[model samples]
Target chain A: MRRSIVNDPDDLVAEALEGLVLSHPTMLELDAEHRYISRKQKARDKVGLVSGGGSGHEPLHSGFVGTGMLDVAVSGAVFASPTALQVLAGTKAADAGRGVVQIVKNYTGDVLNFRIAGEISGDDAIDTEIVLVDDDLASDTGEDDGPGRRGTAATVIVEKICGAAAENGMDLQQVAAVGRTVAQRSRTMSLALAAGTHPGDDEPQFTLDADEVEFGVGIHGERAQRRIPFTGADELIEQLVDPLLEELELGRGTEVLAIVNGLGSAYPLELSLAARALHRRLDTDGITVGRSLVGSYVTSLDMHGVSITLMPLEDELRELWDAPVRTPALTW
Target chain B: MRRSIVNDPDDLVAEALEGLVLSHPTMLELDAEHRYISRKQKARDKVGLVSGGGSGHEPLHSGFVGTGMLDVAVSGAVFASPTALQVLAGTKAADAGRGVVQIVKNYTGDVLNFRIAGEISGDDAIDTEIVLVDDDLASDTGEDDGPGRRGTAATVIVEKICGAAAENGMDLQQVAAVGRTVAQRSRTMSLALAAGTHPGDDEPQFTLDADEVEFGVGIHGERAQRRIPFTGADELIEQLVDPLLEELELGRGTEVLAIVNGLGSAYPLELSLAARALHRRLDTDGITVGRSLVGSYVTSLDMHGVSITLMPLEDELRELWDAPVRTPALTW
Candidate 1:
């Protein structure tokens, strides 16, 4: 039996949003009819920013709907993309005369739905630009092959930088360009020690042996490219960091923003140790980390693993990232 | 076979601290020799607040060492109390010529160690006051009974409020008094859907059947007062809230600051739903929720459960709770 505390799996997304709005009444407003969350104080005449995909990744898109990040977020049921109608509602709610930017992670359903929403918004005379985030190095099969890289934790980086740019009154094209730039500069790779069980399902979406770890696992519990025998933190960090460094083409003295994100159930102690190893390895490689964030920013429901995202920082992106943000999740 | 990502269980705490100092270089300084984390910018001539218990409860003590919360945090091994010498180091590090206040959880080990540190600080000519937090209603006995109550998530409340008071330049006695008051006004009850495994241990500290939940479980994974068949969120909230209301002697028009905290592995989706149910129930009882925080403020390592902490808000306490705070885990 699945021992989830949910009242009903069907109502989980709506109820969670209700709780979010209740806790942050002054900062957020719920569009109950259309099923989206918008900033209580909408930015005026600025290019609106919005992003959402699935529900279980709490604080990712929804916790980010506030002053310095997304203006609206349309949440779907767990690990599933929201309907195009819901995304369209989000775009309309966030638009303030200026065009809106739709940040879509590189997932089949999400990409299709967000594109449809953009088309619908265009018909309604709301200029909507879709910025695709494809930063997962694990899913990389060259720019021409497959669906490109799956967007992972790097979406946080893209949203934050683009949100700051838009808030600074950048036009829709400029904000979208900023989002794409960061997404291009960023890369992420994750490993899963244990798979997460989906709601209403007793079995995990995937299973791993006690001594095995799935490297390059997707956020939705998709199988990694390879399963490797479990070693330890040092080995794991090396496995994650090497590919990220190669993908970013980073080397000595390169300034980077590093994120060590937990995939939900990984404890802080483990995440911290992973961070320590990652930092030491980076230092050994002569990289200068300009900024670092370590936490469960983007999660894969209660999956026990971690993902490391590295974004080589240019002066502009760094400045945008340093700009003040006051969201429920990323406040600095 | 244990499947932790850590390199070594013995060095886990220190490695974690190294990671924390690296992530928040401007805000924190780790004293490796003394095993305590001190604020980089010390609050001069103001009562300094110091707190710690065990290491597994991330963002509890160490994560709160910053501008508006703890001045120093002494971490022990996971789920073990720090030594008196370690606590004394924290006291010395936090003192800025005014005085220091030690916030201690109600566990016997923590109480004894903090008390010893206080006495030692007094001998060193540093005025130190120890504020004992005993707020777990599940472990409550008569006022004079053994240990009063076990401290749980309410420790977060006492520390935040008292830290604000101390940061506002309250005297040592005043800050200590504020801590005690909040502890008195607060009550917490936790239920464990599953027990957390200690580092290096193949088995969890305790266990419950899939359909069973242990109510009133301690943060250290101590068995609860009783085991009951697993119900849904509504029943769990009721079971927790009714006792809390009775213990608080609260009714219509009473105000409270409710914290629906996750104990490690509980997903945010569950936590938010729990918060929603909790708020609706509080409304049905005609209670005015003055403020609310719903997240994993305190945790038992990888335990899949939630703890609800209710702190009745008086005017002074509410003001203190609302004050600005910037820490690794909390910023507002």
Candidate 2:
């Protein structure tokens, strides 16, 4: 087997949390029993921001727990939802009498558990609002019965805006409202050149031929519905960006914040090329990229892919995004 | 051929720089002509910091240009040193009359070019000091005649410490001294599971069997001195740590700042596990980790590997490290 640097696959998440907390001792504290990471010094009398999901997306829910960001983040096994009990504890830990806003990605298990936790937290007089992020344009079937578009990299924007709003002492409703606005306005598209292997498994979840790439892939290692010819950087990034521009209904002179996100193993060089292509494409269409982030924030194990997230930047969203943040993954 | 999302390898570095500068317009400004990135707003009357190397190790010289870090960063092709003229241009760009401290990794080409540039910059009345970083324990041959250990991960610590010292109004000499001390005290060890393929190359630089790993590897995609049985995370980490402890001559109660760096394709889960193993091993050694960083700060071009950097933290060094830094790749 292509060995992973792990003891047992079961112990990976817990040990990782241990290391994360150890590395950021002053900024974070972990409750290993409940599988949640919370800020070391809890903020008081402010709306609490909480987010989480499967464990493989490192620096997402967990790395976001700090000042001016997530107050608590619950995690589960790789690509699996956190248990309702875990989410409940996380939600409770997030409350400090000002209510908690739950920012959850659009995934069935995550949705169910987060909703259950929000409902259960009500018994403690802790009000919670669920801001569901459904930004993945690739999964946008527009069908009412199906699971809606899966959330992708836009979760970073939602978390950042909500965290800033909460840190600004906005009430629960205001924080949740802004977060939902970000979620509603954002759209993302992803493509994978290579699938990631499970920790102990020898084979990748899927394989692509030398001349083809899996387009419209999600973060869970699932294959996309279609394959496209593998081509140059500009062409590939164009494929990802065209759909986002259309889905967002972006018009000429529109301004947006862009995120060129690296899916697990998309290194800095690849991400840089993708970012350049995206900016050039948008500029040609008379759209302005007002703000941007390029990195591997939201990931899917070692999947060699990238996703572009775009959200039309309103004045308030721009200011909120500009607000100071102090988190492991994103600090400024 | 293995498909890379690149249009032409010849234009890759320049385009990536364009993308990087575009993404961080407020913090960075690029001189496309000379191929160096400098701070958007120059800091005056303070010792300037300039560094650069090959292009593949992203977020190195380029991403570190900002308020409290590098003032200028030059670039070259992937895994190739920037030319003397590029270094000269970068040095001139960094000067704001307080002199410049050039942090050069200990590679033949990098060393030769940086020195030539530093010497030539004297004509422009820009005094420069070279803080040579050579911390790779794997390449340590214990002979004075050899080129010395190749600098790897410790360059980050050196750059960070020197930047803080310079920001604190230390003169060029003082900044260089502090930075050199960090480089002197620090040691790094790296290992690769799989070699990285270049952008347009079909094959990797090398390959390892499923049950073997290249121990004592460097940032370049070169083979290690020995191959060892592929083992679990704790054991592999133990192997890396053993040599460091011996080389550093650590005692039971000493404190150190550790950096668990990913060399390209090592993902967060793998890095987290490596960090956990390092902390546990150090704890068993009765050594207190004073401060630590865990991420892909220094990397090969998508090489699947990890490197550990250890430096005994002095009170002065600790304070400098704790100083605020604002750069794209590193900020606190």
Candidate 3:
């Protein structure tokens, strides 16, 4: 039997939203009717920033709906994309006379739904732009074939930088450009020791042997490119970092921001160990780390793994990242 | 066949500490020689706060060290208490002449070690007071035999409130008194759907049947007082909340603060759903929750469960709880 602490699996998303709103009443407002969350105190006449995906990734899109991050987030069910109608409602709620920027991760369902929502918003005379994030090095299919790279934890970095830009009164085009720039510069790869089980499912999406690990695993438990025998932390870090460095074309004297994110069930102790290895490896490679975030920012539901995201930083991007942010999941 | 991404099991705690210091360079300073973490910017002539225990409970003691929480934390090996020598060093590092307050959990080793450290600090002419936290109702030994109760997540609340009091320049006795009051009023009970595995251990600290849950499990994964067949969320909440309410003597119009904390591996989605159920139950019972914090405040390594901590709040306690705090795991 699947063990869970849920009322009805169908009601999990809505109930979680209620809890979030209740805990952060001053910062967030819930539209139960349309199923979206919006900032209680939105900036006037500034471009509104919005992003969302499956509901299981708590504090990702929803935990980020506050003063310095997203203006609105439309949550879907666990490991599922939000409907187009929900995204349209989010755009309407986030609008403040200025245009809205829709940040979409590169997933088939998410891309299609967010695009449809943008079209609807245009028809309603609310100017909207979509910034596609595709930074996953794991799913890299060269240049032409397949569906580009899957968007992973880099979406958090994009939202944060773009949110700061929009809050500083950047126009819609400028904010969207900032998002696109960060997304282009960022790359991520994940390794999983165990797979995550979706709600109402007794078995995991996939299983690994005790001495094995899956490399390049997607956030939704999609099959990875390969599985390898379990090794110590150093070997794993090398496997993740080499590809990321090559993708970013980074070398000695290059300043970059590194994010070591936990995929839900990995303890902070484990994440910290992974981060230590990442920093040491970067130092050995003569890279300069301008800033770093290590924790569970974006997560696959209870998956025991970690993802490394590196964004080669420029002065402008660094300054924007350093700007103050107040959200449930992040504060500085 | 143990599975983990650690350098060496013996070096796990030190490596994790190094990672933490690197991530929060401006806020935390590590004394690896003494096995303690201290604030980079210590407050002069103010009462200092110190707390720690085993290492697996990330963000508990170490993550709580910063401006509005602990001044220093002395970490032991995973799931083991720090030595008296280490605690003495932490006390010395945190002292600012106003004195120091040591917040200790109720486990025998922790209590003894912290007390010995207090005596040694007194010999060094540094005034030190130890506040014993024993809020676990699950391990309550009624009125007589054994230690009063095992400390659990309520230590977070006590540290936060007392740290605020100390930061506001309260004397050592005053700060220690505040911690005592909060501990006296607070009560916690935890339920584990699965047991946690310690580092390097091939087997879990304990085991449970797939369809069974242990109520009142200790943070160290000690066997629970009772086991029952698995039930849905509502029934589990009732089993937890009723005992907590009775222990707290809370009723209609009584103000309280509630924490729905995750044991190590529980997903955020599950924690949020549990928080929602907790709120609805409190409403049905006619209690006024002045403040609330829900997340993984304390954890057993990779345990799949949640703990509920309730503290009947007074206006003073609520004010202290609402004070500004900035730390690795918590910021507001």
Candidate 4:
């Protein structure tokens, strides 16, 4: 049996937003009624950035809001997309004179709601563009007709690079192009030793035996397509990296930005181990890891897992990644 | 059953250090043979700072080793203190021309080894001071003797303040004094929904009934002094705050720096809720929360819990706290 440190499951998202805004009062402000968070001081004459979805994957959309990241972030209930009206409020808030760019994760509900919000924003004379991110290598099916790969940790790379471009006074279309470029090139694969439980639920989303591991998992507490043997950290990371490397077609002398992200319950210790293994493996294959982030940025509600994301580093993307950002979860 | 993403429990610490050093190669360096981490570029004409204990509470001693924090952080195995020889190596490494200050937790083994190391370092004509941190209000016995209180999340505050002072070129005694002031004024209390498991352990340190919470818990996965009925976030915060308020003798018009720290498996959302509750409760008492941090800086493997630490702010201490820091776990 599992328990949560929450009062009411329904109030978790709103309360968390209030708490987060309160924690970073100088850098963030909240529109509580609209259920959105915006920058403490609105930017002017620059393309604004907005991206949000379900609430469970925190520090993702909300935690990414700040000076050099998202201008606005809206929240829906846990694991549920925000309403069209809510997204519209966020997009409107993100609008400076130049226009706004909405970085949407490639989920059906999220994509639909963001599209609707973008269309509605046109009535207010605000130009908007959507950059759909779908980088999960595990969700890649052979058929192009399917929903395509679900977005995962690569969203951070997208929002970060796009945020930097927009901050540098790029037009809406240019920022969208940069975001799309990052999304298209990045690929991620994840594995979980255990699944997460909902806030008030008594049981976990799924169960695994002591000797079994759930391989190729996603961020929304979904089961993996295959189960792999419980093994050493080096071997597990090898399994996740091999497919990504093949999919990215990363050849010798390729330089890439990497992320060893924890899916909620994986601690710094585990992420460090994975990062070390990744660096070793990439060096062996003559792929230089140019820049990397290792932590739980996009999480799955306490799921005990980790994801590896890789994007071939471009000079522009590297500059954007190095740009200063001050947010509640990430800052440099 | 609980399983960790670690192989060969004995190799976990060393491997983790190697991985951490590799991850932040620009800011940190590792002495694998001696099990200590130091700054990539050593500081000159500054008092050196060092802190370390067991390995499980990551991002603690090791993660805080960087430009504005500890000059060196030594590590032992899980829940074990580094040996005197290892600590001597770290102390000697931290010493530049100015001298060194060792920020130690108030644990028997840690205090003993750091003391021995400090004495040994004196033979090299290196002056050293020890700042013992004992901030856990939960373990306060109110006796003239007794082990007093175990240091908890307040170590971060202590390390951060001392690091800033040392960076400003304070003498060894002055730097140690600043750390002691922060440690003395700060107090922390913690409760756990569930205990953390060791790397290869199949069970948690302790079990809590469905409707009970382990209150007054420590960082080593030890049992709490008492069990309290499960309650809402607000009431739990009230229970924790009432005692701290009383203990610190905080008045209605006082200002303080607060930390809402995650013990381990507590996710971002849960911590935000805790932070929200803490802010509301303190505001009601008219206490101005001058500064606050909410995240998992120090952890106990994967224990699902949160800790609250408050130190009444002083102008000099506040300036030091706001000083720029660049470490793996903390940088602003």
How does chain B of model 3 score on TM-score? 0.98
Candidate 3 residue lDDT tens string, A136-253: 8889888797889998899999999998999898999999999999999999999998888787677788888888899999999988989988887778977999989887789898
Estimate every model's Cα lDDT from 0 to 1: 0.88, 0.91, 0.88, 0.91
Kindly list the per-residue Cα lDDT of model 4 for residues A1-332, writing each as its tens digit.
77887889889999999999999989899998878999998888899999999988888999999878899999989999999999999999999888889998888899999999999999999899999999998888877798889999999999989988988888888999999999999999999999998998989999999889899898998788999999989989999999999999999999999999999989888888999889988999999988889899999999999999999997999999899888777789
Docking quality class, candidate 2: medium
Top DockQ hit = 4
Q: Every model's Cα RMSD, please? A: 1.2, 1.1, 1.2, 0.9
Q: How displaced is residue B327 in candidate 1, in Å? A: 0.7
Give every collision pair in model 4. Answer: none
DockQ for candidate 4, C-alpha atoms: 0.84
Per-residue C-alpha lDDT of model 1 across residues B131-188, encoded as one tens digit per residue = 8888889887676758778888988888899889988888888999989989888999
Please provide, for model 1 over A1-332, each residue's C-alpha lDDT reduced to its tens digit, 9 standing for 90 to 100: 23677877788888889988888888999998777999998889899998999988887999998888999999988989999999999989989989999999999899999999999999889999999998888888875867888998999998899999988989999999999899888999999988888876777787778779999999999899899888878789889999888877898999999999999888888888998888898999999778999899899888889999999998899899999999888898
The residue pairs that clash in candidate 2, if any, are none
Off by over 4 Å in 1: A143-145, B143-145
- Best lDDT among the predictions, by candidate number: 4
Q: If you superpose only chain B onto the true chain B, what TM-score does each candidate give?
A: 0.97, 0.98, 0.98, 0.99
3 versus 4: better TM-score goes to: 4
Which digits, one per residue and each the tens of the lDDT, describe model 3 over residues B188-281? 9899987888877767777778778999998999898899777777678768888999888898988888888999888877887887778888
Model 4 misplacement above 4 A: none
Superposition error at A6 for model 4 (Å): 0.7
Model 2, runs deviating above 4 Å: none
